[model samples]
Target: MVELRRSLSLVSTFLILFCTSTTAQPPAPRRSRTRAYIEVSCQITEYPDLCIRSLTAYIHGANATILSPRKLVHYALLASQHRAQHTRAFLLQVSKPLKAKKDQEYQAVKDCLEQIDMSVDQLSMSIKELRQLGREEATPSPSRDDVVWHISNMETWVGSALTDATTCLDEFPGGVRMSRMKATVKAKVLNVAQVTGNALSLFHHFVVRYRVPGSPKKP
Candidate 1:
């Protein structure tokens, strides 16, 4: 009887140890939420004409500010292709009430379009000035520092254009137009930030890779 009781006690101890070990083990860490990429391709087809126009205007403005005038012009020329594709899709999917709301939204888009147009003009002037400066032997060539300053200014202008576009769309409520515009703005912002960050990362990597082993300079 004593041996049997001792055996039962041993079994209980083993069971308790097994249960405690199983319960005490920490759960696998929750997976991180993956960031979603904005698909500007097929989705843009579902928006209204006014929304497309607004998006085109903003894209033009961003390109003008972010790229050379030549590139901006190239992008502007491609705008018609996008217009053709999206127009058909929008007309098919867009409702009459949505169209009516789009007419109202047009005012906001028009204002943004005008501002973007003005920005494009300014960008054109800047490009001309930059070209002329480049041509002048007496003006002295722009230093690397000057190049960086110009790039920074361009980024600031692009950011401002994005802000203006967002403000224009903020007046509207739920709809394909508003949703598309919001998504476009967000995608552009994310893209710009990602590009800038990647460029900086590459620069750091290059600096580190080429650095002298004992150099005091930190990338």
Candidate 2:
């Protein structure tokens, strides 16, 4: 009887400790907040899937906590810049061989290269403006006008870049020899434009959300 009682007491003590330890731990924070950021922010854009895909990189890193509205604007700009750079690289590669031949395709490729170069520059400018916005945010009394102007500039530049991408695609000849190249180039340029367009939409939402006084900020 004594041995059985001792065993029962030990088991009761172990169960109590286990329950206490388990109860002491906090519940894991739901990722729904992070997902809400992607879902809500991407809704304004036509290319929600592309916007979500572009933002996936930032969502997983140590920097994940910085996925606020203002920072999302910065992330979107970076994604646009990255896509623009990739399209520019592709254009540069294809332009080289065609340039040597001086074929009719050379002019098309040359035009695209010029447009892509401009798009890259514009996206770069948008990124710089975002940096400026960050600086302004740290001020004691950041100028709302300054914030508005910078966000507007980002939208304008990104929008222009998207237009340039479309122009590059439209410039390609419908000839059989260039069909494969045209298809490839078109696909690449469209990807850049789609992401840029999505970024522009995100900027618009950021403007609306932050512009209002006493607006509830998202988590």
TM-scores of the models, in the order given = 0.29, 0.75
For model 1, name the residue pairs that clash: none
lDDT tens digits, residue span 1-219, model 1: 999999999999999999999999999975222101111211322333322343345343553331332332223223422332332233334334445777664454455444434434433443443333333323445344444444344445434433443443354444555556435433433332332222222223322322343422211
Per-prediction RMSD in angstroms? Answer: 14.9, 6.0
lDDT for predicted candidate 2 compared with the true structure: 0.79
**lDDT: which candidate is best?**
2
Backbone clash count, each prediction separately: 0, 0
Error of 1 at 51 (Å): 19
> With candidate 2 superimposed using the best TM-score fit, by how many Å does residue 145's alpha carbon deviate from the native?
3.2
lDDT of 2 by residue, 85-169 (tens): 9888888888888888886777877888788889999989988987887787777777777777877787788888888877887
Choose the strongest candidate by TM-score. Answer: 2
Clashing pairs in 2: none
